[model samples]
Each structure stands twice: as structure tokens, then as C-alpha cells.
Target chain A: MSHQSKRIILKSFPQGHPKESDFEINTIEIKEDEVKDGQVLVKLLYVSVDPYLRYRMKQVDNKAFQGYKLNEPLTSICLARVISSKHGSLKEGDNVTSWNLTWQEFSIVKGEELNKLPSNDLPLSYYLHSLGMTGFTAYFGLLSVGEPKEGETVLVSAAAGAVGMLVGQIAKLKGCKALGIAGGKEKVEFVKSLGFDDCLDYKTVDNMDEAIKKFCPNGIDVYFDNVGSETLDAVLLNINDGARLPLCGSISNYNDTKEAQGPRRTFNLISKNAKMEGFLVSKYGKDFGKAQQEITEWLKQGKIKEQIDERNGMEKIVPSFIDLFHGRNTGKVVVKIADE
Target chain B: MSHQSKRIILKSFPQGHPKESDFEINTIEIKEDEVKDGQVLVKLLYVSVDPYLRYRMKQVDNKAFQGYKLNEPLTSICLARVISSKHGSLKEGDNVTSWNLTWQEFSIVKGEELNKLPSNDLPLSYYLHSLGMTGFTAYFGLLSVGEPKEGETVLVSAAAGAVGMLVGQIAKLKGCKALGIAGGKEKVEFVKSLGFDDCLDYKTVDNMDEAIKKFCPNGIDVYFDNVGSETLDAVLLNINDGARLPLCGSISNYNDTKEAQGPRRTFNLISKNAKMEGFLVSKYGKDFGKAQQEITEWLKQGKIKEQIDERNGMEKIVPSFIDLFHGRNTGKVVVKIADE
Candidate 1:
């Protein structure tokens, strides 16, 4: 039961923007015997790339996130199948996903660390977007943190990305006017097609404030911010009283080597009685089932559509991840390593 | 009865720091006949000068806080005595306080807008600090927004100021390790005398980050931020996981004629799973009596001491308010117009 597995590792800390050269792949041989008591051998199915990975690559002293070490295989929330098990719960051929899954074809993981996926006919890749951490992020950040109310205008930045698109549609489903701020015309069109009332192409807009005001004439009631910089500052100036900002990531600043040190329009928070809450999807693990049930219902009823930007081959992992920083793809970016 | 009231009016919007020339005292004659059926004539006892007033001097479109108009009387939360009443609830010689009160010797105010004092025989000026809005601000912001838990480290900026000192003391009372960041050495000493575990002198410190780390060895759990520019940025770097920031004001950036467009270290919020909630004291008006009762007990037991920087004359109102921006006051700055 010997097998060879190729995995991507952090080669070096990127200088400004992450490049393909920053990651290296190494092949390792392991036997099923390595799956000791209370462990399972998992065969990787799909690997997910996210903006938050950039944060892990840095040498941060924060206890919540220890920086990923150099020359080590990077881990993310990945979809995999249990190849062999000596654990109490899992059996071979069970579809499972865990945040601890490595960027490899197969690896030995703690039995308790992996969560078995439900037997659903939906595309297995949908777990990476619609029913996985991405969807849960959209659900909790929008519903729990953002709290978009009926008839209120909810604005989302990076409105075409994995989490953003779902957030916009969900706000609309809740009877709010959904507004989006995306980078390009194509993304804007895509976002608008997803039931967003309006979308602003920040790339073409000369004045961000004016562009935001044009679409959000009534001012933003909830801003689901994925990009944080001047975009957030501009939105701050246009928020309604008691506006809620549910921030997940600042993808715009993730690529920068130095801190942006930009002026935040936080003064608006006091004057407008607004609030900004930063959250991570992992914190909502206990309530994931509740969110997943509703999301599954929405998908089955054709009430929500999640776009997948799939990249084939394990060899393209480095390039596929780098593509995200350059805004080369929309929707949930997942690299296919093996067939489901 | 006819009387002349001396009132402070906005002379001009100052460029950076406000000056004596920015305000002009005007004398106006009013007759008791001007008091409507539901209005009371209140004689000013004490007028408060706070940092938030600086924000009101500028032009902001926020409906929660409209900017002060040119050539008009400036108003704030003031303590007064009803000289005459044409209202159903109030009578002559009734001691009261109102946020709607003008900065003058006497003014006609709607009775519904006034909160009559209970005649607690405590110094009437204490209503402007310890037993009033400032105490409630510290109470709600720290307990509700900051949510400092027992044994957690709570840090407060502008710790010598009215709200900050109380926030630190209240955090201590909640069984937390209270830390403070003040401007000067004397102010830091004053804050320490009020029972804070440690205090940082931002003015004399060479490195703010190092200074904060030195005081907050474990990491900051709750940060009551009054000053918002670089101090906030530095504090962000030292926060613990799940930190709560209750922001009542950003006095550091208030005087800046131009927006401080400095980069906020908000990325820390995402990494530490932190939250920043901007609040106004007025929103907690309904629950103020509970806060006032608790604060009154603390004051009676001498568990907490509120320092007052008293300015004696109405003619010195402009200078007294200006002293705040220059960091000349160590506690709540109250301008006394008349004695009870």
C-alpha cells in the first residue's frame, strides 16, 4: 500500500504580490501503515485557495494564527476521501472535508479532525463553494454579523468572488436591495445577473464616492466588506445610521508587502452610530449544519446559484492560487487534484 | 420677568485647533412670556466642554450629529435650575440637566427634554461627570461594547480624560487587569492614583508599540479607544484574540483639518477575531438609571474617584473648551456659570 503524493509547500515569503515561484511541489512516499490508531488515510479530491492564505504566509506573532512554516506543505479547507481508517467513526470511501487537509494527493490525518460530508447528489465541488466554509461565511457574515434587513440596501465588495456573490443573493432573498462594488465590467455584469440590484465597476469609476452614491442612493445599511482600503473608507462616508459592516478579509491589502497605512473614515462610525465586526468562518462550526440545510434548500429550489472557477490538474495549483490576487477568476477558486 | 442671558456662539470654524476667536459671547434679552405651555426657563448652572464638540464644529452630513451652524449658539449637555416653568412636569427651583441646553446663563427649553435631578445633595456639578453622561458613557461603552471579562486585560486610551478614566476604573471593578494610555506624565500619575494597574505615557514614550507591550504583557482584551490615530494603530497590534473595542470618540484626529488618511491597523481585527463598535452615549439613555445607581454606589463608597478640571467663569468658555485639544485638562472639563 505504498503511494507517492506530490504536495505544494511555501518556498519563500512573497515580497509584494504572491507569485507562482513562491510555492514548490515535493513528492513523498508513504504507506497505509502510517495511519496509526485513531487516524485515517485521506486521498485529496479538491484543494481550495482563499485570500486568507496570504495572511498565513506572513510571519505574524498572533496566537490565533501561527504563520505557516517554510518548506512545509500548506493546509486549507480541502475536500478529500478517506482511503483507509483505523479510527472509531470513519470508514474507507467516505467523503470528508477538513480545514486541516494538506495540499497533496493523500495524507494521514487525525480521525476527529475530518468531518464526513453528507450524501448529496449536488456536485462534490459545490461543498467547496455553496455548502462549505465559503457559503457558511456568506451566511453567518451576512445574517449574523451584517444583519441585512428587509427593504434596506446591502452593499458587498469583491461582489463576484466566492463569498461575495452568495452574500449579495442572500441579502436579496431577505428582501433587501443588493448593491455590489466589483473591479471589472464582466464581474459587475455577473454580480448584477445574480439578482444584485446594482453593481459598481470600481476600475472604471473616476469617483468612488459618486459611483457608490449613484447605485446606493439611499446609503448603505449593511456593507459586507471583502476588500478593505479606500473602498471601505468611501463606503464609511455613505453608511446609514446603525450601519453594520461584516468584514471577512481585505483581499486588496493581502498582496501588499507593507501595511497600507491609509486613513480610515472611522469618524463616520461615531457620527452615524455604525459598527464593524470582523469574523472568521471557523467560529461558526457549531451552527454549520443549520446554515448548510438552508443553503441546500436554496440550491435545490434554484433560488441561489454559486459560480465555480475550476482549475484542472495538481500541477497548476501554484498558478491557480496566484490568479486570485490578480483578479483573473471569479467565484470559488478550486483546483482539482483527482476525480471524485 | 425679563433677563439678559450671556451665550456662546460659533464665531468661525477653526482650521486645526479651535481658538478663543472662534467663539463669541452674545447677550440676549428674553421675557418669561416667551416660555410656551410645555417649556421651562432654565438658568445655567454648569456647561460641559467635551472632545466630541470638536467634531460638531465641522461640516458632517451625518443625521445623528449635525454640525454647528455659523453665527449660532453652540449647545451641549448642561446642568441647570428651572427659574420658571410653564410645564406640567417641572416647577420653579427644580434642578435639572438637558443635552438640549444651550451654552448660556439662561434659556427656555421644552420640559420633556429635561431630566430633573433627584436632589441627592451630591455636588450638582457631579451630574456633569460622575453621576451623569460621562459615567454612563464609561459604563455602557466598557460593559456593553468592551465587554471586559474577569482577569482579562482592559486597556483604555486617553485614560486621563472624562470617559477614559471611568472606563479603566470600571474595568478594574469588573475583576480585570486595567491598563491606561494617557498623554503626559502627570495625567498618567493621576490615572494610576485612580487605581489602574498600569498606564502608558504616549507623549514621552519613544515607541508606542513597545510602551503598550510593556504595560500589556498578556495582550489587550478590551480597548476603550478615545484617541483614534496612531495610538489606535499601535493598540491594534497588541490585542488578544476576540478583543472588543468600544470607540466613543477619536479626539486625536478631530483637530486635523484634513482627513488623517493614515493606515488603520484594522487587519488586526480579522487576525485576532476582534471587533470595533463606535457608539454614542445618547443611545443608552433608556438604561441610564441602572448605570447611574451603580455609579452612585461606587462614588459613595469611594471605590471610584472622578477628577474634575473646573473652569470658573462663563467669559472663559472659549479658552476652557480650547484647553481640551491642547491636552491641558486631566479630567472632565466643566465650565461653571452659576452656583446652586
Candidate 2:
């Protein structure tokens, strides 16, 4: 097992959009032979670049972010393979995903925080994608919070992106008319091909309200929101009675230093008997496998597709994460850290 | 049976706050022998003066304000007694309530909307209060939407006033420690005596968040919100995890021509996985009787107490409605159109 590890640490917190100046990559030496009992040495195969990670960089007293201490390695969901294990139940050559590991290589993790991935005749990347946090987020945010029903119209913002595409596909499987709002013609075509009934290029639309009304004549019944700004405001006005809004992530406002521009149609929630809730996938750890089983089957059956925008090598990791904020990456953004 | 009747008609739509100029009093001759088969002449006794009626005064394309056509009589819920009945189901001298019927000395009402008062001994005013729309709003907002649990903290803004008072009492009955926010010292004392664990005079408070924290150290579980400006912002900061906020009304900014200036905290719903929903009592009219039965039983057994701010004469109706915005009325505001 490799003892020394190279990891990215936050040198300082950025004001809004995280600058490269905020991060410092360093190689730390670890004595592998000094590995204590109940700990496994893992080689991180893939690291996730999520919008939520940007929130963790900010020091806010919020449940979603337990303040990211300065000069520390930022952590989210990382898929790692246990190369050598001293833990009771773990073994060598085991694939496990942990929500507590890093943006680094050679992570030492506790056994309790790790879950052994099931063996399937699918790509190992699916464990970090369609059958992972992104897929489970779509399931819980739509079913538990959004409470989507069959025959209802669902409008998803960032619909061609990783979580959004999965949300639209899952909602379609539930018999809902899925509408996607993306940034460009390519992403719009991409989401439409992924099974959304209609895909709108928000960049091309002059009037969002008219564009939304054209797609949802009966009004939006369920809103799976990933982008919350003017898009949320537009969706709010077209909501029907008893509409449910699941706040997945607000990538649109992640970089705003001050409060984001106030949404124009926030009062619509009161008038329409609508409700909006925010949730993190960590809250659904108990029921992850239940969603994983369904998502895995869908992936295996080709009912749900996986699209990864994989950047090569550990050197490209920071740029891949930064590209997420600039809307450059489509589908799941993962950095291939090392060989499988 | 009287052949003459007096009615109030809307001469024009109100530009802002409704004034005496917006309405006209008129007398019409009713043919006593021409009464329809399912119709009864009801002599009006009590007319409810609600804040929602003010919203109806401003012409708008909303369900609450369906925009009155010129020179038509304005109508709302009125507790009345059958003066004469051509309908076999209702006899003369029966106490009843109906949403239909003109604001007048006498008006004809169909049998469908009319409900005879419960024969069990209770104040006739209770029909306008703890047994009617006010009760249903509290029951559904607190029990169903707010979802209060025993020992969990419940906060009601405008607590001593109308729906807030009933909601606090109901929360108390459900074993929650209830807190109320009222305008004056008297109203705070009044709600305190009604079994609320604590009451804050929001008018006198220097910092409402500090005051609320003093009352609810465990953090807020359910917030029955009728005032939706700054108070809601304070509640947003104090909400516990998985809190439910049922937005009953926003009397605070109902009359403002401009959007109210307050900290918008819809984003807080995401961090706490909290839910905020706006509701109308009519949406749950199907279960009104079920809720009314429980409230009436409690009222009859002296398990709950109530207060009514009664103003005599139909001409005083405008003042009664205005009192709601001023937070001067406690419990229910009822206009005594005539002595029974």
C-alpha cells in the first residue's frame, strides 16, 4: 500500500467564486505500516465535483454546511477502492463509497463511514453516478420532498446536468411529463434525447415565462430545482395548486457574495398553496440502497443512461470543479485520479 | 314576511384601502309571495369582518378577489336566522350560517350553503368563531400543515388575535409548548392566560429574534404564520430541523402597495429541510365538520376560552375589517347587523 498521499487543501476561503489562489496542492507522508486497527487505506479512483462543495467552502451557520475550517482538505462523496484493509469486514480489492473522504489520493477512512458497493456488470463509474449520490438525490428530492405523481407536469432546471438528467428520467418513468431547462442547444438536445418531453435553451429564450407556459400549459405541478434564481422565479408564477418544489442545489447563486437578487415570484408559493423544501443526500443515508437498487436496475436495463465528462489526471481536478461553476461541463463531472 | 330589504352594493372597485365611497346602501322591494322553492329569507345577525375581504375589495384576477362587476352587492359569510322559509327543510326561527346572501337587513339564500347551528347549548357567536372558518384554519394549519408534536415548541405570530389565539390553544392541547406574538401588553396577557407558555408583545420588542429565542430555547418546531414580513424572517433564523411552517395569512403586508421590506429567507427552508405552505380554509372545507366537532366539544366543556370583538350595525362593518389590520381585535371580529 502507498503510504504518502497528495491532497488539495483550502489555503483560504474565497469571497464568492472560488479562485485557484484559494487552494494549495501538497503531498503529505503517511506511515502505512503504522495503520491502526479498524482503518483501511483506500486509493481514490474518482472525486466528485458538486455545487454543494462550493457551499461548504463558505463559513455559514447552516445545517447543510458544517463550517469548512481554513487550511483543511475539503471533503464530499469520493469513490475509493480499498487496496489493503486491516478492518474486520473489509478486504483488499473492495470498491466502497464514502461521503466523508477527500479531493485527494490515498484516504484513510473509518469502517463505519464506508459502504461496500454491490457487484454488477456495469461500469464502476455508475457507483459515483446514476446509482450513487446524484441518482439518490433525484429519487429523494422528487419522491420524498417534491412528492411527484403520475400524470403531473415536472419542470427541472439544470435539466441536462448530472442530477437534473437523472431527475427528468426518473420522473418520466413515474409517468410525468418532464420538461428540462438547459443553457445551450446541445444540452437541450441532449436532455430531449434523454427522454424529457421538452427541453428549453434558457440562453435563447427572451421571455422565460412564455417559454415555460408553452411547455407547461397546465402549469407546473412538481419543480425539481437545481438552479434557483430567475429560473425559480419563472417556475413559481406557473405553479398549479398544491405544487411541490424540491430545492436540490442552487448552482446559479453559489458564487454570489451578497444575497442573490430576490426572486420575482416568491409570493406565488403563498397564493398557490405551494411548498418548497431543501434537502441533502446525506440525510437519506439510511435509505440509499433502496434507491440504489432501483437506479442500478434502471442503468442495467438501459432505462437510465450514464454520461460522464471525465477529465484526465489529478492535475485537471481543480479545473474540472471550476468548470462546473462556469457551466462548461455537461453530465456528471468526475476526475479520473488513478488507474482502476 | 317582510317585503322590504336593505343591501350594501359595491359601486366601484377600491383603489387602495376601501373607504365609505366604494360602497352604496340601497333598499329593494321583495315580493313575499314570489319566494323560490329552495329559498329562505334570512334576517342577518352577524357578519364576519375578515382581512381577506380587504383583498377582495381590490379588483384582481385571484381566487380571493374575483373582481366584482359594477353595482353588485358584496357578499361574505353571515350568521343568520330563518325569518321565513319556502324550503321545507328549514323552519322559521332556525339559526343558520351561509357564505351566500347580500350584506343586508334581509336576503334570500339557497339551502346548499346554509348549515343549521348545533342544537347543543353554546353561544351563537361560537358559530362565527371556534366552530367555523377560524377554527378550521387553526386545526388544519396546526395539526395537518404545521404537524406539531408533543413537547415540540410552536410559535404563532399575531398569537392573541383571531386564528393565532385558537392555533396556540390547539397546540397547547396537543401537548406542545406554545408561544404567541401579539401587538400589545393586554393581548399578550390574554393569550398567556389561554394556556400559551409565553407571549411576546412584538410591538414593544427591541429584537424579536432574541425574544423568540428566550421563549423557545429548543428552537421552533411549527410556525403558524399570519404575519409574513419581518416576523417570518426571525422565525426563519430560529427554525429547528424538519420544522413545518403553515402560512395562514400575511396580514402584515396585505395592504402595502409596494413589496414589504424584510429579509427574504426562503433559502433557509433548504438548510433545515423545513417546509412552508400557504393554505386557505376553503381548501379543506370537506373536513370542516370533523374539525368543528372537536373545537365545539372543547368549547362546551370549558377546555378552551374565546373572545369576540363585536361592533353593532352593518355600517360599522368597514371599521371592523380595518381593526383586523391594526391588530386591535382579539379572537374573532363579528359585526352585529341586528339584535337576534
Best by lDDT: 1
Worst 10 residues of 2 chain A by lDDT: A260-269
Which residue window of length 10 is worst by lDDT in model 2 chain B? B258-267
Instruction: Please tell me the TM-score of chain B in candidate 2 relative to the true structure's chain B.
Output: 0.94
TM-score of chain A of each: 0.97, 0.96
TM-score on B-chain, cand. 1: 0.97
- Chain B, per-candidate TM-score: 0.97, 0.94
Best by the DockQ measure: 1
- Model 2 lDDT tens row, B1-340: 4556777888877665666787888888776566689988788899987777776776667764454556988787789998888887898999999765568888777866699887777878778888888878889988988889999999999887778989999998999999988988888889999999999888888987787777678899999898887788888888888889898888877777765553366667778888878777778888998988888889877888888888898788766776788777877899898888
lDDT of 2 by residue, A74-132 (tens): 77777889877889999999998887687778877787779898887887777778888
List ranges where model 2 is wrong by over 4 Å. Answer: A1-4, A261-267, B1-4, B259-263
Looking at model 1 chain A, which ten-residue stretch has the lowest summed lDDT? A58-67
Clashing pairs in 1: A261-B263, A262-B262, A262-B263, A263-B261, A263-B262
Q: Which window of ten consecutive residues has the lowest lDDT sum in model 1 chain B? A: B58-67
